[model samples]
Target: MAQKNYSGVNISVDEEGYMTDSSQWTKEIAKEMAKEEGLNLTEEHIKLLEFIREKVLSGSALTIRAIGKSGFTDIKGFYQLFPGAPLKKATKYAGVSKPSTCV
Candidate 1:
């Protein structure tokens, strides 16, 4: 386990930087995470994050293809929203574990 300081709160994370406890997640933490990734959370980004979190909580698996088909955005749009490993980065900031499909 590792720790990341987000807005003065020390949150626990795994080796790959995914939050260990979803309860520790906050919008502030999410914002901080996005800042670390050189992004500013837009309304669309928040929508996608909420969508991903809801899907995960409902016991659905996530994939780029699935996300693309969900209508939130296409693959290119997703990559634009979250450059470089869109699924990995989006899920990380969403306070969820790295998707199984990610390396």
Candidate 2:
């Protein structure tokens, strides 16, 4: 595990930078992560992040197909918004642990 300080909160993450504790996540942390990915987060992006976080908290699997039906966007739009590996990157930005489905 690796530790990183974001907005005065220290959190532990995996080698891929995925947060280990979802409780430590904040919107600020998500924004910071997205920014680091060169993404300029908009309201839509925030909504999608919240959607994914909610699903994860509810013990649902995070998948590209599931995210597409989130009402935020379709699969193509998801890729447009999140670029490569939408599930992986979005989960990382949402401060959720890496999904088991991801390699």
TM-score of each: 0.89, 0.91
Q: Against the unseen true structure, what C-alpha lDDT does each candidate score?
A: 0.88, 0.88
- Which lDDT tens digits does candidate 2 get at residues 3-94? 99887889999999999999898888888888887988888988999999999989987888998888889999999998888888989989
Off by over 4 Å in 2: none
Error of 1 at 49 (Å): 0.6
In candidate 1, what are the lDDT values of residues 1-103, reduced to their tens digit?
7888999999999988899898787788998999987899988998898889988877788888888987889989999999888999999999998888554
Best by TM-score: 2
Poorly placed runs, candidate 1 (over 4 Å): none
Alpha carbon deviation, residue 60, candidate 1 (Å): 1.0
How many times do residue backbones clash in model 1? 0
What 10-residue stretch in candidate 2 is worst by lDDT?
94-103
